[model samples]
Target chain A: MPVQDYIRDRFFPHIWCPGCGHGIVLNGMLKAIEELGLSKNEIVMVSGIGCSSRISGYVDFHTLHTIHGRALAFASGVKMSRPELNLIIPMGDGDALAIGGNHFIHAARRNIDLTAIIMNNRIYGMTGGQFSPLSGHGIKASTAPYSTIDHDFDIMELAKSAGATFAARTTTFHIKEITSIIKKAILHEGFSVVEIMSQCPTYFGKQNKLGNSFEMMELFKKNTRKIGSNKKLENKNLIERGIFIQKELPEYTNEYSKMVKIAMGKKNER
Target chain B: MKKNISFIQGNEACVQGALYAGLDLFAGYPITPSTEITELLSIRLPQKGGYFMQMEDEIASMCAIIGASLTGCKVMTATSGPGFSLMQEALGYAVMTEIPCVIVNIQRGGPSTGNPTHVSQGDVNQARWGIHGDHSIITMTASNHQDVFSVTVDAFNLAETYRTPVILLFDEVIGHMREKLIIPEKDDIELIQRLKTTVSEGVDFRPYLPRDDGRIPMADFGGTHRHNVTGLFHDMWGFPSNNPKIVDGLIHHLVDKINNNINIIAKVKEFHIDDARTILISYGASARTARHVVENRRSRGERIGLLELITLWPFPSHIIREKCRNARFIIVVEMNFGQILKEVKTCIDKPEKVFLANRVDGVLITVQDIRTILRIVQ
Candidate 1:
C-alpha cells in the first residue's frame, strides 16, 4: 500500500522539524498498520498534546487529539466499547509517562487490548527542551537550567510492572525493528507498549548541542542494544531494545465479553 | 441488540432507555438510588455486545464514559453528590470538547454526602455550573418513576442530537421509587445518533467545525478520517489558537445551537395557569409536593398554577416569562437552598416576587413545606 493511502494528504510534509525522528516513526507506524491488514475504518488513533500527538492529525483513521495525558484513558474507553476495533495510542514521554503516568499504569494494569507507542524523545520538544520524565535526570534543559537531580522514569519497566502484556523499546534508527515490534505488539491480545526512542533534533538537540538530525539518529543506534530476556534490569546498569511479551492473565476483553454474555441473558452452559 | 420488554423500576427504566437508545457502554461505580441502573445495564448491555464496567470510582467511571462517547458510542455514568463532585473536571472537559454523553445524578442531600440512603433535590445548581467555564448544557429532571423512564430516554436522544453532554437530573425519590412504566416497544421510540457525514479519506476532518447553524458533527473513532479534538478552543481545522474574535465566534455558536433550537429542546408540564394569580414552579421530586399543594388549593377553586420543568437547563425561562406574565407571585421549590430559584429570579426582572421553598437536610420536600410558601402568597 502507498504511504499516501494512509496519510492525511492535507497534513503532508508534517509540521515536524527537519530531520526530526517523528517522521521516521510515522513511517514505521504506517508500515506496521499496513502489515496488520487492518482498514483505517477499523482503527482509532488517540493522542495527547505534544510533538508526537500531531501524528493523529496525519493518519487516515478515526482520530481524537485529546487533552494532555488522557489518551490512554480515552483509548481504554474506545477499546472497552468495541474490543474488536484496533485502537492505537501515540504519545510522547511527557504526554504518556509524565503527566499521564497514572492513567497509563492503570490502563496497562487493566490489560485492555490496545497498543501505546510512547515516542521517548528525552525532552519536551513542543515547549522547547524542557526535561521530560525519560530524560537523563542530571541532563540540563530549559526546566533544568542547572544540573537536575530528579530520577528519570524507566518506560519499559513501568509498563511491565503495571501489567503490560507486551513491552519493548526501539528507536527510529532501527526502522525495521520498530516496525516488526509494532506488528508483534499489535498481534498481542492485551495492553502493549512500544517505546520508540525517537530523536528530537530540534529542542533536545539544541539544549545538549547534540548537533544535527543524523548525529542524533546515530546516538539512538548506538544507545539501544537488542536484548532477548524477560528478566528485569536496572536502568542504571544497561540499556537494551527488543520484543517482550507476558501473556499471563486473560485480557480485559475476555472478562468483559463474558459479562456481556450474561447481561444479554445468555445463560452460561458451564 | 436483542429486544425484550418487562415491567421495571424507574432506575431500571433508565437502563432500558440507555439500551434502546443504542448506548453501547456504561461505566459507573454503584451508589444508592442509582445502583439498579448499573445493575440492569450490566445484565442487559452485554447481551447486545456492548460494554459495561463498574469502575473503581465515580471519577474513573465518568472519565471512561466520556472516553467511550468520543468513539461514537452512546455512553453514560451515574452517581450522587460526592461522586458527582469527582466527575466535575471531566464534565468540564466534555463541555469544552463537545463529546456527547449523559450523566445521571441521582441526587441526595449534601453539603457533603449528608445522607446516602435518603432523598433530596440538591445539586440543581451544581448540575448547571458545577465546573467553572462558559458553557451551555441540556438538563432534564424526572418527577416520578414514569418520567424517569421517559426522560432518561429523552436525555440520551437530546445528548446525541445536540452533540453535547446531557444531564438526567434525578433525585433519590424518583431514582429509587418503583412505579408502573410501560416499556415501549422499539418502534415506539426515535433514537438519534450523533451526525456523521462521508468525507473523502485523507482529508483533514475538523471535528469541531460548525455548520451554518453552529452545530458541529463528531468524528466516529476508527472511521478512516483524521480529526483533531481537544480541550482548548480550536478553529475549524482543530488548530489551537487564542484569538478573541474566534473565541467570541465559537462561544456564541456553542450557546446558539441550543438557544436557536430551544423550541425543540425546552420541555415543561404546566397545570391550571389560566387566570391564576400566582404560579408555583418546581421540578424533580419537589414537583410532587408542589402538585399536592396546588391540587389542595384548587379544590376550593383557588387560582393557583404549577409549572413543572421537565427540562431544567436552557432554563425554560421564555415559557416562564410568557406564562407568568399576569401572575402576582412565582414560587420556586427545590431540595437545594434556592438553586433553580436563582435562575428563575434572574430570568425575570422582579426577583423579589419569586419565592423560594428549600429543603437541604436530606429529607423529601413535604406538601406542608410548599404550602407554607403558597399560604404566604395567598
Candidate 2:
C-alpha cells in the first residue's frame, strides 16, 4: 500500500521539530495499519495532549484528539459501545505515565481490547524540557537543570505486570521492527501496549549532550538487543526489545457482555 | 399504550425517562443521593440491549458518555455534588467539542461532602458556570417525580437538537422520594434522534457547519463521513486552527447557537402572574413549597404568583422580566444558600426586588419559610 494513502493529505506539514522521530514512527504506524488492510471508517485513532498525541490530527481515520491524559478513558467509551470498531491510542511518556499513570494501569488491568502505542521521548517535549517519569536517572532536563536524580519506569515491565496481553518495545530507528510489532499488537485480542523509544532531538538530545539527531538515533541501534537474537549481551545495561508478554485473558467488554447475557437470561427465567 | 401510573422514586422515573427517550448508553459513578441511578441502569440497560457501565470515576464517566454520544447514541450520566465537581473539566470538553449528552446532577449538601444523604440546591450556579470558559449550557429543574420523567425526556431532546450538554438538576428530596408518576410508553413519548447524513468516504463533509437555524448536523463516528474531532478551537472540518477570524467565529457560534434561539431553550411554568403584586420564583424541589405559598396567598385575597422554572439555563430572563413587571416583589426560594437567587438578582434592573428564602441546614424548606419571608418583607 502507498504511504500517502494512510496520510491525511491536508494535514501536512506536521508540527514536529526538524529531526523529531515522531514523523518516522507515524510513518511506521500508517504502514502497519495499511498492510493490515483496515479500512478508514472501521478504525479510530485516539490521542491525548503532547507533541506525540498530534499524530491523530495528521491521520485520515476517524480521529479523536482529546484532553491531556484522558485518551484511554475516552477510547474505552468508544470501544465499549462499538466493540467492533478498532481503537488505537497514541500517547506520550508524560501522557502515558505521569498524569495518566493511573488510567494506564487501569486500562491494562481491565484488558480492554485497545492498542496503546506509547512514544517515549524521555522529556516533556511539548511543554519545554521538563523531566518526565520516563526520563532516565541522572538525565539533565530543564526541570532538573543540575544533572538531577530521578528514576525512570521500564515500559515493558509496567505493561506486562499490569495484565497487558501483548507488550512490546521498539525504537523509531528500527522502522521495520516497529511496524511489524505494532501490527502484532493490533491483532492481539486484549489490551496491547507498544512502547517506541523515540528520540527528542530538540529536547533530550540537546540536554543530555548527545552529539546530534543522527547520533541519538544511532544510540538506539547500538544500545538495544532483541530477545531471541543469538548474541550474548556484553553490556548488562542495554535495553531489551521484544514481545515481553503474550498471554490471552478474557477481554473486559466481552466478559461484560457474557455476564450481562447470563444475568438477563436468568431474569427472564425468573 | 395507555399511561402506566405507578408509585416510583424520582430516580426511577429518570431511568424510565432515559429508556423512553431512546438512551443507548449510560456511564456513571455511584455517589450518595444518586447511586440509585447507577444501580438501576447497570441492570436495565443491558437487558434492553443498550450499554451501561459504571466508570472508574466521574471524570471517566463524563468522558465515556461523551464518547458514546459521538457514536450517535443518546447517552446520560447521573451524579451528586462531589462527583459533579470532578466532571467539570470533561463537561467543558463536551461543550467545546460540541458533543451531545445528558447529565443528571442530583443535588446534595456540600462544599465537600458536607452531608451526603441530605438535600441542597447548592450546585445550581456550578451547573451554569461550573466548567471553565465562556459557553452556553441548558439546565432544567424538576420539582416532582412526574416532572422528573417529563423534564428528563425533554432534556434528551434538547441535547439532541442543539448538539450540546444538558443538565437535569434534581434535588435530593425529589430524587429519593417515591411519588405516583404516569410514565408514557416509548411510542407515546417524544424522542429526538441525532441528525444523520450519508456522504462518501472521501467527500468533503464539514461536521460543524450550522444550518440556517444555527444547529450543526451531527453524525456517528464510524459513519461514512469519518470526520476528525478535537477539543481545541477548530474549523468546520473539526481540525484545529489559530486564525483570528476562524477562532472568533467558532467561539461566537458556541454561545450564539443557543442564545439566538432562547425562545425554544427557555421553559417556564407561570401561575397568577398576569395580575399580582408579589411574585415568587423557584425551581426543583423548592418550587413545591413556593406553590403552597402561592396557593395560600391567593386564598387570602393577595395577588401573589409563582414563576416555576422548568428550564434553567440560557436562563429564562425573558420570562422573569415579563412576570416581574407587575410584581412589586420577586422572591426566590431554594434549599441551598442563594444559588438561583443570584440569577434572579441579576436578571432585571431591580436587584432589590429579588429576595431569597434559603436553607442549607440539611432540612427541606417548608411552606413556612416562604410565609415567613412574605411576613418579613411586608
**Cα TM-score per model:** 0.87, 0.97
> Residue B4 in model 2: shift from native, Å?
1.4
Tens digits of per-residue lDDT, candidate 1, B154-241, equal 8888887777889888888887777767677876878776788556666756667767655677666666555666667778766555
Q: Write the residue-wise lDDT of candidate 2 on B1-378 in tens digits.
A: 566788988999999888888889998988989999899888888887788887778888998888888888899999999999999998999999989899999999988988999989888889999988899999998898888998899999989888899999998999999999987755776678887655555678899888876768877878778788898999999999999999999989899888878998898998888998998999888889899889887999999999999988888888788779777888899887787788888777789888988888989898887888988886
- lDDT tens digits, residues A165-199, model 1? 99988988999998899999888888999999888
TM-score of chain A of each: 0.92, 0.97
Which ten-residue region of model 2 chain A has the weakest summed lDDT? A228-237
Off by over 4 Å in 2: A228-233, A266-270, B1-3, B198-201
Candidate 2 CAPRI grade: medium
Computed on C-alphas against the true complex, the DockQ of each candidate is: 0.46, 0.69
Candidate with maximal DockQ: 2
